[model samples]
Target: MESGPAIFAGAAFTLFGAALLLWTGVRARQGEPVALGVAPRAAVALTTLFGACFLLLGIWCFGRL
Candidate 1:
């Protein structure tokens, strides 16, 4: 695998995941919906899960490089 593309993708995933996680936290703190029309708890859980998965995948990609 090319280091340049891997690095770019890894960075993108990491940033996106971090944004999702941070957004969820900020919205939860303000009593806003983490996802529109979804239950607060479920939305938070789902968003967090996705964020974690993305973060892990990014880390894995970076490790490969």
Candidate 2:
């Protein structure tokens, strides 16, 4: 409920998503197949969507400040 906690949570989520996406990028470049038990292309798509969602959620949290 506090601003500080909210900001921390948002930052954590944003960082996690960014890291996940970055890993995906590396894997794709290496031509590795399957991520999270799925196809490479699907993995990329899911990670992209989840990463965007994380960014949006973080922005929403920050906006409350």
Native-structure RMSD, model 2: 1.8
| Model 2 agreement with the true structure over 1-65: per-residue lDDT tens digits | 49898889788877877777777788888988637678778888888889778877877777877
The weakest ten consecutive residues by lDDT in model 2 span 32-41
lDDT of 1: 0.91
- TM-scores for all candidates: the values are 0.94, 0.79
| Colliding residue pairs in candidate 2 | none
Task: Name the candidate that leads on TM-score.
Answer: 1
User: All predictions: root-mean-square deviation over Cα?
Assistant: 1.0, 1.8
Off-target runs (Cα >4 Å) in candidate 2 are 34-36
